[model samples]
Target: MDMDTFWNDFQLVRTGNPLVLNVTNHVVTNNTANALLAAGASPIMTFSSREVEDLMKISGALVINIGTLNTQDIGLMHAAWSSANAMRVPVVFDPVGAGASTLRTSSSQELLSLYRPDIIRGNASEIMTLAGEAGQAKGVDSSLGADAAVAAARALAQMHSCTTVVSGEVDIVTDGNHVYRVNGGHALMPRVTGLGCTATAICGAFLAVNRNRNEAAVDAMALMAIAGGMAGAMAQGPGSLQMHFYDMLYSLKKSDAERLFSVTRD
Candidate 1:
């Protein structure tokens, strides 16, 4: 990945502050919103089906998370997704804990069947499960490694005709035809709740600016990995890591990417 191009895209978000409409769950709502602000994207979290279409008019991107799914909220998510599709805004889907429950898995499948998401970001188990692989998820956490889900990610991408991101110690971003591996994040990242959700939200921000959806997803993973590495180095624990994470996101520069950006095309 080119650091100059990546820096330019990050600056676009900082300057443009693209509005991102999120029909996300309550569990990680505040965390994801704060992450979007740190990444210089405006976040609007509203699940009201009545106003989803109106909100999509000004949104540059839409992110739908099924972390805390319910019947009523599913309708709202579908409404938001429909509006996003109609508006031609990029949609990023986070199938949180997809394999952990029948409802979560079925709801995720339902959404995918209804409309194709521009990008689908999840952990190894979630991606594997979504791809119809024999994946075992310990609740929302992936029981398998990221590399174990590469084939599944590729299949899922090809099946849906969209990008798939599998997050782990080494993140994998694939558009079925091309695959990119990003390595830099720390173990402390998973200790914090909603960091994965934050990554999905940040992907939406990058997608809003970059026309190349594949590279946009790659850059988003790169940003997370590099920034997480920086924050982990300075943080004594997960609490400080979260604080330093926001700081790193707001102040990230090409120099930081130069030092930590480790990506390979496969």
Candidate 2:
């Protein structure tokens, strides 16, 4: 997909808006909320099983990020995922650190096997782990390269029958068929805690408006890469990039965003 196509979707989110319900983790709560608002979509964070079914029925999309999962939270996620499934609401799962520990990998796999996520976004290592590649993940970071995880991503996408996003310096997105590579991002992004999670939220925002899940996933990654790259260029370091990245996100002109995008299919 082209950057202009991606830019148009961002504009569409502002114009033909949708409500996004996030049953996400706590680590990047504030960042996720702000990013959604900046992108011109409404974000509501709640994991109550009581309200989840009703919420799922009402919201345009439902997002589940297992970033900070506790026993109670996992229960809530299962309930929320079930509710989302019943309603067929677009579900986006960020399996953060899917390969970190037995618990994390198991929980993520359980979610995938049970839920109906329209999109799954994570770094290469996380995707690799989900593909059952034998490796230990140190928290939510990736030890695998982007290209190295392509087969795993393809397999996982086929296994889950959903659009999969494998993030990296040059991110790759697919749906068991088409593979779109989004090559635009700063190395400093990994230095930040919630940037990847932030990207998940952005995907949530785009999915709020876009109908085609694969295109939306591809476009969201392109936007992240382009915007992060531009913001990083202006940043002195990760600290500066934190401020500049949001500024770039808010001040991102469609034309400028298009110019920065560099996605291709192989």
Q: Which candidate should be chosen as best, given lDDT against the real structure?
A: 1
lDDT of predicted model 1: 0.92
Off by over 4 Å in 1: none
Clashing pairs in 1: none
Residue 255 lDDT in model 2? 72
Scored by CA lDDT, what does every candidate get? 0.92, 0.83
lDDT of 1 by residue, 1-266 (tens): 57777788999999999998998889889998988999899999996899988889999899999999889999999899988888788999999999999999999999999997999999999999999997879999988889999999999999999999999999999999888999999989999999999999999999999968888898899999998999999999999999999999999877778888888999
TM-score of 1: 0.98
How does candidate 2 fare on TM-score? Answer: 0.95
Extract clashing residue pairs from model 2.
none
lDDT score, candidate 2: 0.83
User: Cα deviation in Å at residue 3, candidate 1?
Assistant: 1.5
| Cα-based TM-score, every candidate | 0.98, 0.95
lDDT of 2 at 20: 86
